[model samples]
Target: MKVIGINGSARKGWNTQSLVMKALDGAASMGAETELINLYSEPLKGCLECFACKRKGNKTGGICAIRDNMRPILEKAHEADAVIVGSPNFFGYPSAMTRAFIERFLYPLSSYMMKDGQHVRLLGDRVIPAGMIFTMNADPKSYEMMNYQATLGATTANLQYVLGYAEQYNSYMTLQFKDYSAMNANMFDGDQRVYRHETQFPIDERKCFEMGRRLVAKAKELNQ
Candidate 1:
């Protein structure tokens, strides 16, 4: 089995990257193939609403038509057996890089639906199981306090609803450090402000390792 992990943290060796790597490590240990895509390094574009994908009788769903950086990653994500995305919270949501990546996912499935006589909910539950990792500044308690409802929940919640293949969720956080100075001292020497923030500065290093291993276990549990 193969799985892909995406790091949307924008900074290398920071909280989001570390966590996504960790999860991939776990998947690797289980003999499952995996790869991590760095969002910042990729050139992704925003949705132009060209409607070429939605055009009737077009089987490709406008996926191949959009000329942007997200095309390759989106293709791999759809083909993988399990996929995971790791993003740091920015204004209570995944960073802009990550958000843009999520939008690209709409293309392929939309195309599958428009294809010639293939009808079964293109992105339906049985397609492939997926998961997400929110490497934010908040603690698990925050999600509990909110009753599992919070702004950071927008992406995962939407994916689960739309794709119905969401199989697991894992998190690693560094809470309460909101500024660059604090984050530099705690997480990545101030260079990773994109990942460092108040309420969550540095993720627990051990947890990073554990979260990754858990992903591998999860894949086995679900698929086997």
Candidate 2:
């Protein structure tokens, strides 16, 4: 089975890419064919508030009126057995790149479910198994983007239960740190330091790699 990854980080190969690559590698190790797609580089944006999918005849048939790059991604997205979406939490929510893709992908599907007066399980068996990874830079006591998880849950549920695309299990990883040790006199922000006491790279590269591997494992389980 082929698994697909959509990286939603604007920083190209930053935390998002690193995390997604790990998941891809884990999937590869399990003999699952996989591909990673970068959403930021793709030409697309959030829903235009255009009700074309819901207002027009595209409902139930799962057609998006917006004929753009999203069309191709939608085609590719459906071809996969599993999808892993990774994004860095931005401004108390997912990045714009991720939000844009989700809108198009779920709009038609959800409209079909809601537009009709029936409580029909439009999602039924059409939904694939999906996983999500969210990363952020926040300290333990800080509520940085803490509310994002709820928003994600609501969106995922609507997409999974209403649109019937996939089951959504999620993983969360964050870095709590400060470049200036003066921020925390002890240089201790709940056990982990922002930078290695003496490493060339300050970030936790190992954690990133391990997370990738775990994602792939989950993908394999879902595919199987």
Candidate 3:
């Protein structure tokens, strides 16, 4: 079994990468081949709306026609038993890189067809186990107030619809900086902003690990 983790964060060694790595480690523990792809390091372009993949009788075989760094990654995702997508929340949604990666990943596999006189997903018969990790600055209670939960829910629904099974892990109230002095710390309550990164971050990391392991287990079951 093989599981691939994709990190959408531009900053290395940050919260998003940490969680993705931890998840890959967990999958590794399950005797699954694991790999991590950092999107920031790759030359990925957004979907060009070229309709090449959607063309009738196209020969692409459910793969994006765009020839770039993302093409190989999308192919890997298509072949992998499980995929873990990690992205830091930007403006209550996924970062641009993450959004682009997902679009390219899903678009080619999607097809329009009529079923029972209604449009349906042609590739819906294929099922893949997938997981998502989101790191955000808002706390759980404030996620609704910030509208992050609703926006993220829609993303999760789309993934589930396309991938068959999808789950998410959230690390909320993330520390954006190592030192408060590096940025305008006055805007945040210093006392409330003081997060125990050393302690709590590990807990979040363990959750990511479990998510990876769970995906692998589910994929294995499906394969069986």
Candidate 4:
């Protein structure tokens, strides 16, 4: 079984990447081969709306018509038994690269036709378990106040609709910088942020690890 993790954060070895790597480690522990793809490593674009995939008898099959840096990455995702996408929540949503990746990855696989009250998926009956991870500086209360669940849930809903099964994991109050004092952002208490990172980040890591393990287990059950 193969599971892939896509890190949409530009900063490698940071909170988003750390959690994704932990998840990949968990999948590896469950006897699945795993790979990590960093979206920031290459330039990519969102869907171009060419509709080539929607064209009758299209030669591209279910893949997007765009032949760019994301073509191979999309192919890997299509073949993956499970996929985990991680990003640092920017403003009220995921990073720009994460959103672009989602568009390029899902738009081709989604169809306009509906049957039995559900849109037909290009993958047909294939169930590829998927997961999303978000790291944010906002606390839980701010997250709720912003109605993040509604907006973020919609993204996961689309993933579930296209990919069969999708889940989300969130890490709040994430450390944004190694030396907070070095930056000019004075809205937060640097000491408290550091303390939170030292105390709570490990717990988040463990939670993501379980998320990866559970996703792999679900993929096994579905593919069995």
Candidate 5:
């Protein structure tokens, strides 16, 4: 079994990447060969909206027709038994890199054919388990206040519609700095935020690892 983890964070060794790595480690422990891809290192562009994938006589076979660095990564995702995608929430949604990658990855595999007067997916009936990890500086309560839940819910629904099943894990109130004094301290309740980071971050990491293991287990079960 093979599982692939993709990190959409621009920073190396940051919260999102660390969580994705832990998930990959969990999958590896389950006897699944796992690989991690950092999008910061790749030159990925958003979908061109050329509709080439929807055109007749297209030869790409459900793969994005774009010629870019993300093509190979998308191919890997298409072939992998499972995929773990991580992105830091930006402006109530995924970062630009993550959103672009997902658009390019999913658009090609989708179809606009009408079935019973409703559009239907033309992608193959393959079931690929996927997990999404979202990291943010706000707490769960603040997430709803920021209206991030709607964005996350839509993204998860799209993934489940295209891929057979999808799950999400969120890490809230992430620590952005080692020293709160380094940034604008007046804007935040530094004491409470720092305390949560010091106390809860480790628990969130454990949850990421377990999510990875569970993702692989479900993939294995489905593949069997």
Candidate 6:
């Protein structure tokens, strides 16, 4: 079994990447080969609407034809038994890199053809369990007030529709800075942020670990 993790945060080894790594560690514990790809490590662009993947009788084989840095990442994502994508929320949505990655990743696998009144996916009947991780500065209440679920939920919904199964996990009130004293952002209580980071982030990590293990198990069962 193979699982792939995508970290869409520009800051490496931060909250988003750390959670993704924890999830990958959980997958590895299940004896699954796992890999983590940092989206910021390479330059990638969003889907250009080239219609290459939409062409009838095209030889693209369900892969994007853009021929960019994301192509190989998309190929690996498709081949994996499970995939976990982690990104920090920006303006109530995932970061630009995450959006770009998914635009290329999911669009190619999507099809206009309908079956049983449902849109067909190039993935066929294969079940590839996937997870989305979002880290944000808003607390649970603020998140609810912002209605972030509607924005982020769309990605999870599309992943499920295209890849068979998908789940989302959000880490609320994430610590955005290592040294808050240096930054001019005084709206937040630095001590409270550190306290929450020390206490709540571990719980989030554990939950993400379980999510990883559970997704791998689900993939094994469904794919079998």
Best by TM-score: 6
Judged by whole-model lDDT over C-alpha atoms, candidate 3 comes out at 0.85
Model 1 scores what on Cα lDDT?
0.64
Q: Give a tens-digit lDDT track for model 3, residues 77-140.
A: 9899899999999988888899999888888776676779854754445567888899988788
Please report how far candidate 4 places residue 106 from its true position, in Å: 0.5
- The lowest-lDDT stretch of 10 consecutive residues in candidate 5 is 118-127
Which runs in model 1 stand beyond 4 Å of their true positions? 61-64, 107-120, 140-148, 167-224
- Per-model clash counts, in order, read 17, 5, 0, 0, 0, 0
- Residue pairs with clashing backbones, model 2: 22-212, 23-212, 123-164, 127-165, 128-165
Please give, for residues 134-203, the per-residue lDDT of candidate 2 as tens digits: 6665442344346655765665665556433443333333433434454654534533533332241223
**Higher-scoring candidate on lDDT, 1 or 2:** 1
Q: Where is model 2 more than 4 Å wrong at Cα?
A: 55-60, 112-118, 144-146, 162-224
TM-scores of all predicted structures: 0.70, 0.69, 0.92, 0.97, 0.93, 0.97
Candidate 5 per-residue lDDT, tens place, 106-160, comes to 8887777778986575555567888899999888888888788799767777788
TM-score of 6: 0.97
- Least accurate stretch of 10 residues (summed lDDT) in model 3? 188-197
User: TM-score for model 5?
Assistant: 0.93
Please list the C-alpha lDDT of all candidates, in the order they appear.
0.64, 0.60, 0.85, 0.90, 0.85, 0.91
Question: What is the descending lDDT order?
Answer: 6, 4, 5, 3, 1, 2
TM-score, candidate 2, is 0.69
Is 1 or 6 the stronger prediction by TM-score? Answer: 6
TM-score of 1: 0.70
